[model samples]
Target: MSKKVAVLVAGSWGTALASVLAANELDVVMWTRSEEQATEINTQHTNTRYLPGAELSPRIRATSDMEAAVADAAAVLIVAPSSAMRAVTHQFKPFYTPDMLIIHATKGFETESLKRMSTVISEELECEEGQIVVLSGPSHAEEVVKRCPTTVVVASLDKTSAEAVQGLFMNAYFRVYTNRDMLGVELAGAFKNIIALGAGMSDGLQFGDNAKAALLTRGLAEITRIGVEMGANPLTFSGLAGIGDLVVTATSQHSRNWRAGSMLGQGQKLDDVLQSMGMVVEGIRTTQAAYFISQKYGVQMPIADQLYHVLFQNRQPRDAVEALMGRDPKTEMEVMKLETWEQWHS
Candidate 1:
């Protein structure tokens, strides 16, 4: 019998992954709250609203019934948005077993609690936090659906679980790498969206490549700073989940965070931009969380600070740019001299 994999909440990324599993000869079942979406996937084999112009494999199926979706499934992937992570995991409480491999591909922190997706999953599912695998990197749903070459990193303290997920998702077009620094991987994945949004605003303002180059470099430093303060390996910030994800997100047209920021730069109101996006711009929520996190950690995240003001304080994007350029001069290695850096190494 073929192994069954259950995917929660069939969004663009989830559906794209479902296609990958189906192509690999696994029986894929997607659970959606909307019966209409479930019917569309089961009968039409396409989620036109999310991933248009692509056909799904016959091995893929959809169900609105949560229990049925997970029944006998070897693995259950939780791809719910950060805001929905808790409620969605609670839905799994009735069905989850100790042996079911749990994986999450969601990026961004829980806005209210500022918790990583893995932490929230473990909390709701009553499992050890180390057991949940986090799948992240530069892969975008739009490109992955077209069979584009993509690579991602999966991290877990449980080495065997990470290897199992890597085996489950790796294929000719999709490659998976394993990283032991799960904290860094999750931190990088969540933090990059903020930089990507900043990058989009820069481009939208027509600030050119020089500004973007500087933003990305400094943005990475702060991400690493906060990650290190939170007990992550600094080297992980240089890996695929860090630099690789940041570059792709900040530069790609496929990034919703970037798109939202671009619209903001182009003079659109937040409500208007979000309405037009028809999707959750995770970075918008993430920025608020980042603001609180930086304060708590005593980490100086200048770019994130500026973005938080521009996003929530209604400070003009142009003013944010000016503030950044006008900052007092400091050595480039100042990032290495933080108290957290010294303490972390000590």
Candidate 2:
């Protein structure tokens, strides 16, 4: 018999992953926080609220009981939003075992402690670093659930574990790459959303493609800066987790950060935009956390700082852009310092 795969959370990303696992003939059980979503997935085989018109596989079971979902599962994938990740991990603490492969599909960090989702999972679940894996990239739940062509990276400090996750998720249309730099993967995943928020602000300001292009390039610099400082491989940022994810997220109309940024750019209130998203826009909280981390680590993250003001300080998006543009110009790599090959290794 195929291994039972327990996918936690019923959000769009969670449902989409459950669909993928079920299609691969794994016995998939999805734990939803809402009974309505559970009923929809189990009875209707649809996640109408999040991914409208997408059909989920009937093999995927839905439940609210944490223990029932994780029991006897071969692998457990945590797909809850970053904000809820801590609570979700606590709920699963009783069932956690070292033998089960744990994969976190969340892409952001905790706002309070600025802890990465996988970090929070490892600490809360009482597992070692090698026991956790992060699967991230340009994957949009709306597209992946529909089997649209997509690619992502499965990263862990343990190469074997990363490969294990890569093998399970890889298919013809959805390709998976493996990386050993868990720190880089998570940082890229969390920081790209900050850039997407900036991109959304530019779009909201009715700025042309040129402005958006500059933001993306500079944002990559900002992302790489903090990532390398935090002991991540600099090259990882240039891969699927970095530029690839940033391109898809910042430009895609489906991105929640972009949508929220657009509203902010148009002078709308943060609360109103957030209320409309319904689901947590990971970038909003991440912006604050990353902003704090950047300052604490002395990493130059102008984009994150600007977005933090826009989201938290009620700064006008247009004014924030002007402030960035008005800053002193310097060599591009001045902040990144990724010039010499030895600097990367050191």
Candidate 3:
């Protein structure tokens, strides 16, 4: 029997991953809320709204029924937007079985609970948190569907589960790596979008490579600082889910967060920019969550703080940039203190 995988929510990333599994000759079933979308994927094999101009594999099928998608599946990969993750997982709970491997490709936290996607899924499923694996990295759905060479990481507290997910998604065009730093992987992946938004704002404001480069650099520091304080392995931030994801999201036109930030930088109002995008820009909400997270942890995230003011408080984008540049003199490695480095190495 061919391996079967269920992808929840037929969004761009979900569809792209379904295609990869289909390529591996797995029986792939995708669940969507929209009957129209399910019909399109089932009949036309195309997801025009999320992944326009891309032909999905015929081996991939779509359905609107939750039981139909998850029934007897070898693995269930939840790719719902973070905002919808809890509800979606709750819907799948009735059908979820302990024997089925659970993985999530969703990034970002529950705005209400400030919990990671894996944590949210675990809570809903009533399972050990370690059982849920996170698939993340620099691979954008746009590039992945095109079979552009992409590398990603799947991480879990359970090594066997992580490796299982890695094997299921690995292919010639798409490479997968395994990591045990589940917390760091999730944290880095979510936190990097905040930086990417800042990067886009920098570009939109006509700041050159120097400014953008500095943002990416210090942005990593800010996220790493918080991640470390939150019990994440600092080295994981240097890995794919960390720096790798951060670089692509911050620089690529494919990044919705970056594009949204660019518009904000160009003086567009938050409501206006979101209206133009027509897609969920994770960074906007994430910036809000990160604001409270930084305060709760007592971590100084200068870039995220500036973004919060710019996006929410009507602080001008240029002023945010100026504030970042005009901060009091400090050592470059303040966030990555010597003790933290030693702790990581030890």
Candidate 4:
């Protein structure tokens, strides 16, 4: 018999990942707050609201009850949005054990706390932060559910934990790599959304390929700048979590961040764009966090700054573009290195 693997919240990504685990022949149980949705998954075998045309594996199941979902699971994967990370993790805590492997696939920081998702999970679970493994990379949930050739990196300070997760998720169509740079992987995954939003804005503005290309290049520099400032290895930014995730999110039509930015560029209000998206636009919240993070850390994030103004201050997207294009002159290469970041700075 396959061990049960519990996934929290059957959103698109969560549902997609549940499918992957089911394909691997694990008894996948997904936790959802919606009883109707659970019934739909159990009976119809489709999540039409999210992945419209995709057929889910029979091994996948859904429930509205949280404890019931994790009761007999050998491993638990949390895929809640960043906004609900704390609350959802708090709910998952009573069932947590040091022996059960815990992994999170959420991308983005806690806007209220400016902490990474892993940090929030650890604090709630009362486990060493290193015990948590973060799964991230260029893989899109849409593609992964299709059993498409998808690759991702799993990072943890615990080598054994990383390798264990690598084994659990790896298969022919789904390739997994292990990275020891936990901080870099998480930061790269979250920060790239800001850039992807900007890329979509550039495209929405009809700024042409040259403009989008420049945005991606400089956006990476800024992401690496802050990632290193937060004690991440600079080399990690060159890997899948960094450059690879950045490229895919910034360019793909599947990216909500890109779609949100495109709507903003098309002159729609942020509130309306979000309502239209009808799903979580991570970059919007992430941009809010990044703006403050850059300020708190004393690092310069020109692109993020402009986006903040555009997003919150009602600065026009074109004006944001102009502000970026009209920055002060300096040496083209300014390095970001934390001379030993004491601890994950609050």
Per-residue CA lDDT of model 1 for 104-166, tens digit only, reads 999889999999999999999999988899999998999998899999999999999999999
Per-residue lDDT for 245 in model 3?
A: 98
| 104-139: candidate 2 lDDT, tens digit per residue | 989899888888888899889888877799999988
**Candidate 2 TM-score over all chains jointly:** 0.97
lDDT of 4 by residue, 244-316 (tens): 9999999989999999999999999999999999999899889999999999999999999999999999999
Task: Please tell me which predicted candidate would have the highest TM-score against the true structure.
Answer: 3
- Candidate lDDT scores, in order, read 0.92, 0.88, 0.93, 0.91
Distance (Å) between predicted and true CA of 330, model 2? 0.5
lDDT of 1 at 200: 95
TM-score of each: 0.97, 0.97, 0.98, 0.96
Off by over 4 Å in 3: none
Model 2: per-residue Cα lDDT at residue 191: 91
48-140: candidate 3 lDDT, tens digit per residue: 999999999988999999999999998999999899999999999999999999999987999888898998999999999999999999988
- TM-score of the candidate numbered 1? 0.97
lDDT measured at residue 220 in model 2 versus the true structure, 0 to 100 = 93
Cα error, residue 303 of model 4, in Å, equals 0.3
| Distance from true location, Cα of 132 in model 2, Å | 0.5
Q: Model 1: how far is 112 from its true place, Å?
A: 0.8
The RMSD of every model to the true structure, in order and in angstroms, is 1.6, 1.4, 1.0, 2.8
